[model samples]
Target chain A: MFDTVNLEDARRVIAAAEKKAAAIGQPMNIAVADAGGNLVAHVRMDGAWLGSIDISIKKAYTSRAFDIATKDLATHSQSGNQFFGIHASNNGKIMIFAGGIPLKRDGRVVGAIGVSGGSGEQDHAVAEAGAAAL
Target chain B: MFDTVNLEDARRVIAAAEKKAAAIGQPMNIAVADAGGNLVAHVRMDGAWLGSIDISIKKAYTSRAFDIATKDLATHSQSGNQFFGIHASNNGKIMIFAGGIPLKRDGRVVGAIGVSGGSGEQDHAVAEAGAAAL
Candidate 1:
């Protein structure tokens, strides 16, 4: 059976991420996905960048689909790296960036959280806050 | 300037749609979009079909893009119809079927909601519930 994040869990994670975003003064679009790489919940904070909405959701899917932090994926997907063309796959859903992280349960990846609408460091920080809540 | 649904409005709409989906005994994937056809929020219930995820988001985009229910658009998009090939437009984002409804404010289209993971009728019903909330 596949373990995954539920709606309630997604809400809690989002709440934490929102708090972190507020602290950093960067509005963000946050998204959560289940183990199946299906979106569970998403939120675009007031004043968040509209374009980041799609990126945030797709980042969540990419993290869950690959069960890896997108920051690491970005490193491996650079020009001379093994995953150079991976982003062209997945119908453009693969987001090799710093804002996607897997959510773990009992040391197994159960889902993922993605944050956007800020610099890479800020987005990654917000996602980490959300993932820690899970 | 485009008057559009905000993040708070999207959540209220999603909550109402979820309630209706639960009443109808069907899990659903729901998505809400702004007047600009950008996503504001999306949710997939615990047992919602995974494949419907993309459909739900695209349906919302289609409704907002055309400012019409996909149900009505479907009729006009039938074989040999004027809009028969419209679905092939928008880089394949158009969904000529039920479950999408435009959200109006002061007699103006502002945004839209889309639902999936059930029969077309059920999906339309849920989307109607969401639109009513807006």
Candidate 2:
């Protein structure tokens, strides 16, 4: 059976991330995706621009699809040949950068969460809060 | 506070519709959007062509953004002028067609779900199944 991430879990993750982000005085857009790499939840903070939503989703999608954190993907892409075309191949949704965390339970990836609209370090920190909540 | 649709609700809706479609031997692409018109979930059946994902998402986005079923938007589009350019305006993600249903709870629209990769009528039936589950 496919491992699933449920709503309550996603909400808790998002809430925790939001709290951490608020404490840091950062506004962000967050996105979550299940094991199948489909989106499960998302939020754009009040002051966030609309484009942040797309960036957040792309980061989450890349994390889930590649089964690695997006930061790792960025590193891999830098070492790449075939990976160069991935963004175009995935219809512009696979973003290889920092800001996404793979959600793991029992050493298996269950989903991923991404945060955008802040510096890469801040985004990673917020995403870590979400993953820790999960 | 935002009225959110969780992963459990989205999964149940998608599962119910997938079951119904499988019972009828139909291949489809399904999409779900949260209240804000951003994608919450999507699935493209094995036999479905890749393009169906885009179609399904566009339908769901249109439904959530307009707070009207996609079919109704199609009808409205036919009724005339100002509605014509919406597709272009939304970066080509709005499909005013007969394959999307708004998900409602307590008479308030909670989200929307869409199905494509089949005949419009078939897509509508699958979307209805998803809505019923919600």
Candidate 3:
């Protein structure tokens, strides 16, 4: 059976992401999803952008559902690109942008973390911190 | 200006709900929403049903959007009732069932709490515990 993230793993990832957000002086909404792209946990930091809550959760689903970082997906999802309009799929749950990273174990994707409430670079950085924790 | 639930408040509510769920020996997915129907936080307890995640969040939104317990809403939303088919509205966000309750402060609804993963009665009980904390 494939290993998947659990509540403890999700909390660890979120804690790391929160640290990175604090280091950068940016509050964020962070979400973790298991191998099935189902959310395990989520948090919207105090004063974080309210709109990012859904985006963070959807981003984690997008990453684990596709096993690719959302930053890479954004490239192909641009206009005239291979994945153009793909965001319209999954009932608008696909988020093609930076900030989502798949967590790996034994070189296999086990889960994903998504961060929002900052620029693409900052979000990606925070997600990287979270993924590293896993 | 009307008060709205924040991340801190959301955490407190979730903690109370979690305690109640533990006492009942039922893990659950819990969600809290701000007055604007925006999600503040969510958590899926270990071993909770995956499908309950979305249901919990939507239940919170539905509760805040209508300022009524979903148990009561279900009564009015049944076939041939005044609100029959109301679930078809809100882009599938409305959950016409138990477990969603408005969070009120000084006689005004400030937010809502939702719980899923158990029977309707259990879910409603957990939500009530969360709302009581807020």
User: Which candidate should be chosen as best, given DockQ against the real structure?
Assistant: 1
Which candidate achieves the best lDDT against the true structure?
Answer: 3
TM-scores, all models, native as reference: 0.95, 0.61, 0.94
Q: Between candidates 2 and 3, name the one with more favorable lDDT.
A: 3
Give the per-residue lDDT of model 2 (tens digit) for A1-134: 87757555776788898888898998888877778777666666655555677888888888888888887777767645546656666778888888998999888898899889788889999999989999
Cα lDDT for residue A82, candidate 3: 95
**How much is the lDDT of residue A94 in candidate 2?**
84
lDDT of 1 by residue, A12-125 (tens): 999999999999999999999988887899989989998898899989999988999898899999999999999999888999988999999999999999999999999999
lDDT of 1 at B26: 99
lDDT of 3 by residue, A1-134 (tens): 89999988998999999999999999999999999899999999878998899899999999998999999999999999999998999998999999999999999999999999999999999999999998
Model 1: lDDT of residue A23: 99
Off by over 4 Å in 3: A79-85
Top TM-score model: 1
Question: Which sections of candidate 1 miss by over 4 Å?
Answer: none
Q: What lDDT does the true structure give each of the candidates?
A: 0.93, 0.79, 0.95
Q: Grade the docking of candidate 3.
A: medium
Model 3 shows how many backbone clashes? 0
* Model 3 residue B56 CA deviation in Å: 0.6
C-alpha RMSD (angstroms) for model 2: 7.0
